[model samples]
Target: MPDDVSTAGRPHIDIASVQRLAELADYVVPFAIRAICTLGVADHLVDGPLPIPDLAKRSNAEPQALLRVLRALAGKGIFTETEPGVFGLTPLAQPLRSDHPVSLREAYPLLVGDLQAWARFDYTLRTGRSSFEYVHGMGYWEYMVEHPEESKRFDGSQAAGTRVEVRTVLSAYDSWAGLNSVVDVGGGNGMFLIGLLSRLRHMRGTLFDQPHVVANAHGLLREAGLTDRCTVVGGSFFDDDVPSGADAYLLKRVLWSWADDRAHLLLSRVREAMREDSRLLIHEPVSFPGDSDEVGKAYDLILLTMGGGCARTEEELHALLGGAGFRISRVIPTPMFPLVEAVPAT
Candidate 1:
């Protein structure tokens, strides 16, 4: 509704129409990124700009198709065509490379490869249930169990994120300080634990996750020389009692994987094992009021489509945690996410 846009309007203004087109065609951008990653185009350009033939040969892709896609990607500023038919990685494309410390190499596949789950995104909208299960005839966790390579890729993607998230959480909260033990509920591959115990040598850590996922952690821990106090125990949070007598329980990015009922059930499991003195910390990427960042919004959609989970508001989380017999002492917000601290309810 700009001054230039009119009700005497024969049609929407050109700018608005083009913006709508941009939004509708948003899938092309990520798909282009995925294409580049899949083709290993960025790796070829790592040294310097190359002619289309060289790039296509290096990536083992069709020359014309690679040129067309690279040209389209360059239009979005992901790459540069300094000279016609030659291209190189731009700063944005650099992170997509395989060796970047926080690489998105494996993450791009999730966006472009999971067609069955995404095809049922509308089911999530209609039923408020998991679209992944709706389409695949199995829950997201179950599907992961059936596809171990996919599970490993997902774990690696999330582990890439822990490098940054761990720093933010550690700096934001001190409750882990001087604590003898912490149980990482749903911790993946001991990435967080390695970072945690590295900083806090006095702390012993237990990583509890699915059997298949935790099965791989022993080697990771051994590689990191964390086998002494760091341990990996495998069990489902929904079906098993959480290990008791820990000074604290840590659920990093766990709650948003399920709906309220399942999330509450998982929390209550931890609550059942809590000593009057045991502390619980949950890593929540809260969607704040009036926030409109696209990445966070898209992440919320991913949880919805994948497992009917969501990034909850503080009020929503408070109500859910209350139902699980814990009280939120405070929310320590960092730029990355909020670390919510809870003590067993009186």
Candidate 2:
């Protein structure tokens, strides 16, 4: 036998490489779960396990295909095949339910909605441009406006994240307690403003975004019992002037979607709207100094391929704010992201 051969004269197997290959093959799970989510399969399985044919009938999926999907998911521990052709939810699948406490029903769709766009993500890496534009022949925001149904799902996803942000800002930043009024620049559907004003009963807010986006905000603001406390304005923040002279101006989850030039323009517009006494609050996902910021890094890549934007570091934010004629007063760290408070540079 050759020295390189095993005792039985067989080739040695590389288990690590095999494991890596298996991991790569696991990409199918995301699309599988996305299909399950789109079909509302988990919703039907909520009460208990059902046979494949019945589950398919309820979910509007083909019987054999649903059985295979269920089996594949069960292998990954997301769902269970209780018997030959019956399936049920595992604890991990609960969040996929629309009525679950921490439902990801909408978020999953938003995450995987750009299925085709991602196919051209390599083009973005090659040309440093948006794959979304390449794939759809339109920018991300433009596509959202043109497709109202997708835009609604995006809003629903943001609403869930906004609730977390509201809770974090209230507990982490003390300055909000003293501000009487704030303006939310580029606020989407006014979810953040609604949450903020609802808690800070003494404080009021102005929600500004595109006309189509703001139209939905009015009903939500009213539903939150903030009809009298908040004002909704519809206009492009870049083309139109921001609401002027509020106690604070908020750019929450807004700045990450543009390149430096456009981000600078937005900051300058907000700065122009600010008075000497006005505080500018930036609530965004800031990329920290270490490898610990995996989520921040992932979001940065999404911004890169989805639009021509990036997640800024603390230093990057400092430079951007300084360039926009503002001085950082404080930085409040939160589990969600960072809240950077700034004042007009004089």
Candidate 3:
């Protein structure tokens, strides 16, 4: 028998709806954590468990306000409340510690600080324009050229992230065994060249980037003691030809920085310079369709916002390489990025 109670007597709650709301609410936590990490709150706690007042003092944040932020983070297992007002770092917060091997402090702030520009992301969705160009008055590269300090932060933060990935890439590739020279297209500060040359004693390398970028490469080369073996070339990839006659040409995190047209142009330039047997190695986070990975999705938005760049699928890469007069030889996966090796199709 049906109950006499009206339908309105039943509870109006929906579990799925409640869960979705909870997830939406949780999104702000990561930004808060980014803010705290950027403020070096975790570094201050490194010495010992500290009260909220002292922690706020060290981080230069207001005590009451900072406590509220930390309290929210504490609920997420990032930090723990030792007692009434004392807080201590947790295992999950270890990466935020400035001195950690793979510390994300710099990377976190760089991303979060750029959040303001993203408020205009709807402009990209509506007009197919870059959020950066919509919010700022210029493209990312132009802005970087004008703002030296911000450029330094952007370069340093990117290089720091690249350091972890580069080691994995270096291990995945067989040493440039028979190659005399390798050209790293768009190599900023020669981080990749340093890693490769460190392993291959017989190899000489060229680090090609903008004038200012290359200006700093010599210092890195000297620090790595590869100044005698490496050359730093300052020129635009679009206007100038990459140094020709190298056995292997490398583009790490470069192609994804442009749209299809620009990528095609860059690859075509590389093809024109390549000998019949020259190899091209492209290292990037290759996206696969229908597979929505977190890093790929986040990077997709980043590329959209930063410079109208994007993460490409394997099929897209194949078509781009094919159009550029190159044949896909192999796609090797590393711990970080996938290396797509190609040779002149002719």
Candidate with maximal lDDT: 2
lDDT of 3 by residue, 8-49 (tens): 786556778778899776658978887897788999988778
| CA shift of 220, model 2, Å | 2.0
lDDT of each structure? 0.82, 0.85, 0.82
Per-residue C-alpha lDDT of model 2 across residues 1-346, encoded as one tens digit per residue: 6645687778667788778899776768988887788888889988999999899999999999989988998998999989999999999898788887546666666344377788888999999888999888888878988888987777777766777778888899987777999999999788888888988999989999999878888788768888999999999989999999899999997888777899999999999998899999888878887668545667778788888567898888889889999989988888787889999988
TM for every model, in the order presented, reads: 0.83, 0.80, 0.82
The C-alpha local distance difference test score for the whole of candidate 1 amounts to 0.82
Off by over 4 Å in 2: 1-25, 48-53, 80-91, 110-113, 144-156, 167-175, 275-278, 330-335
Error of 3 at 72 (Å): 2.1
* TM-score for candidate 2, residues paired by index: 0.80
Cand. 1 TM to true fold:
0.83
Question: In every candidate, how many clashes are there?
Answer: 0, 0, 0
Top TM-score model: 1
The candidates, ranked best first by lDDT, are 2, 1, 3
Task: Report the Cα RMSD per candidate.
Answer: 3.3, 5.0, 4.8
Model 1 worst lDDT run, 10 consecutive residues: 106-115
Worst 10 residues of 3 by lDDT: 107-116
